[model samples]
Target: MNAAGFNPSERHPDLEMLDGYWSDGNQARLPINGVPECFIDLDPSHGTLTLSVPADGPEPDLARFRSIELATYTDGGDVWWEIRIQVDDSLHEAYSLLTRIADLVQLENQAVAVATYQALEAYRLLLASRGGMSDEQQTGLYGELLVLEHLLRTLSPELIVPAWMGPAKEEHDVALPDVHYEVKSTKGEHRRHMISGTQQLEPLRGVPLWLVSIQLTPTTPDAGRSLIDLVAVVRGLSGHRLPRVNELLVSAGWRDRDADLYDAHLTLRSKPRAYLIDLSFPALTDARIAQVVPSASLVRDVSYRVDVTQLDFAGPPSPMDAFVEIPEEKTE
Candidate 1:
């Protein structure tokens, strides 16, 4: 009964028995592409997908993850949900990606798919370290992700390695073989931005390291968008093109279920400025830190903020290939 034939590199035991469920015409569990314990049961006749859990399983609030279609069932008073959906190949790809992410996190909740979405976003933002991140840091991370997504849309499509994935504390936020991009984002009115570590903005000999500044206004009831709004619109539109950005969002402390928790709205008030961080740029480099330290001990934990507000640029920031351009800055 292997009807829809999708070949995995290797088959999981659960998937091996997937077709057997068809006989019941109800549903059965199979841990397919994701975690060994994550079972997704499908009812072809009804076109539904479900992840059942025992009464004690952690149940995450999913009221905000709008794409989910929920159905409840009780087996001897133990509650479960069929978070079903009729998915096409593209949507199915998204599901598979989420499933793999959930597997990696070893999720223990009934909202496995939703949690997977959050995990993927977390991975993208590079917050794999244990413990929770602050809301302000999360907001800042979201801003970084928005800049990444905006860059992808503006630049040519190519596989890009996120800054967090590089060897610990890489200089730039994003690396693309030839050039590097360091993304800085702020919510404040002033052009103040923080550069972590002296090495971050310090340029290498040959390769170009460009600094991108993104600023957003606060969210408002009448206008502005939340992280959820950005994710929903992009996922709904881009389909397969979204998984990459989704990872960044998750890394930035985004969870599909917690979308509503982020009540803040953000409007980009100005065009993201891209400048070449060369010798002329204002920053605390390793060379400079050594001279300033009393013992000249390596200041590995150095982080400083620079105000580029009134710096009179001879012309404009250095040219970058396909960096995002602001159509119009919204002023509320």
Candidate 2:
């Protein structure tokens, strides 16, 4: 009974094509601590072992080929104990499973990044359409909030700012612990006193409110129509009456009638003057106006509190840009 034990060194003539290491010595019969005793059929042609053991071995819960290593022997002797079985196929299968898991993680991360960018772009366009520059300070504040919202959305779905706070008077009802914001913006070089009462108190409480201020030049070509000008334009042109040409020019600070021709180029009948404002105080940080607003030049002071930070600006060609393009259809 060739009791040299299982000899993995001796290559099987037919099993050599099975693509794995084999035992060289005689097959050995041994019992495992938790396994049932049974007969196994060794096929050298296919390099596989068919276990004749009953299914009554440990309920198959932990019966994985990779979990157990095998050895061979003969005649119940210790000689064949030195030979070990190679489980190359089992190892290869485990490695492939791990690789697939890593690939799935990478794909998930990429999808999330792309989705974040798209959400930000869509929000940017939405704000530009609803936001108005008539009040440069308010418009600037709106732009900032939109950007902050985009960033928050990428991190968590629960962190969100509502689209509307009802009328300007109902800001308090919508305030949350960490999620409320109230923005106050102004134009000009001087700081103005902003008084807060019951009307604007709730939005300013313990929430993370941010105050933003913008300085603008009235004559700067890039300046869009201000909120005041928009209101005036709407009032003047709503009826058949053409808007007052003189008021429009004066508000724009144009002294020369020769320069008045510039008004014709503007799509809107009137444009409001631009004023640079100094944002002196963030209301939550200080109780007194003197502590916040600085005694400086050309600064118009306005104060409002908000939770979100500035993200993007509204401008032409940006979603705020009014011009739309129509594609021409091909004719047969």
Candidate 3:
């Protein structure tokens, strides 16, 4: 069975062991193998993933990860972060949620805090997509993730997620300490992209803006990476910062539950190229429109297409790997 089809309630051999502990007055515990200080507790009525921490340790911000009613209780001078889920009807979702939290808790020393952040981030992303992502949306997110993968080479996931602004509907797709980027992907042969509005191409006061064009070629699933695969790669690289990565993915309309719907695979036509959005770049900004047509102030929702196939733009063929920054250089 696939991951979603695996039923822990019926299949886990240790379920009966927890039942014995629960039948008595004691809280039944099953230590989650390989994860430090983590345990599982279950009865026929409910299930819970528990993380035991020092009473004086940093507490998880419950408000951060709010989907499940996580509780913190002190027993015998130790604090426990209890993640409970009703397994009777929502066993699959409960298992998925607990495992995701355990995955984060496994990686960090601050178990409860990290798990809380991860759970919160997962729900935030999953909730953003009320339904499955569209084919076009998946293609767009794929291109952005490619850029994210490149950034992760030198930058940490913590630095990259905040710089990723596309999901927040910011003017640019990425904003590093020194520069900002607008990412675009197209199946067409030429370097063409649809600009959403006059403000999309507008750069900040002093920060340089760049237009990153990615060419994607549709291919068989075996020949290229599907959206789901690309997301997994990025998440694997995120380490303890997986929750922040989920925050961006959800903002971009990706939901893990709908992974099967995003099987369309796309191969990169070429390395993503970043063209500096200088005065010579082909674009229609509000300032330019007002200068050319004095009555342009009356226009709203202005959008157009620009093809840079023949433009003499200054940039390397593969521009992503060259961009890097230190955390101190970032702006608020």
lDDT agreement with native, every candidate: 0.55, 0.30, 0.68
Q: The CA-based lDDT of model 3 is what?
A: 0.68
Displacement of residue 36 (Cα, Å) in model 2 is 99
Question: How do all models score by TM-score?
Answer: 0.52, 0.22, 0.57
Q: What is the C-alpha lDDT profile of model 1 across 9-64, one tens digit per residue?
A: 34343343444554466755666443334456666675455554332335544444
Find the 10 residues in a row with the least total lDDT in model 3: 2-11
Backbone collision tally, model 2 = 38
Where model 2 places Cα greater than 4 Å from the true spot, the runs are 1-163, 166-168, 172-177, 196-205, 220-332
Candidate 1 runs further than 4 Å off: 1-133, 160-169, 219-222, 233-241, 313-332
Clashing residue pairs, backbone N/CA/C < 3 A, model 3 = none
Model 2 lDDT tens row, 152-252: 33432232223223222444312334544333333434333243542343335445332222333344345454333443443343233223333322332
Ten-residue segment with the worst summed lDDT in candidate 1? 1-10
Per-residue CA lDDT of candidate 3, range 25-114, in tens?
Answer: 455555565536566665543444343433334666554322345577877776666765534234344555565566566655445666
Better of 1 and 2 by lDDT: 1
Q: Candidate 2, overall lDDT?
A: 0.30
In the order shown, the candidates' Cα RMSDs to the true structure are 11.9, 29.4, 16.6
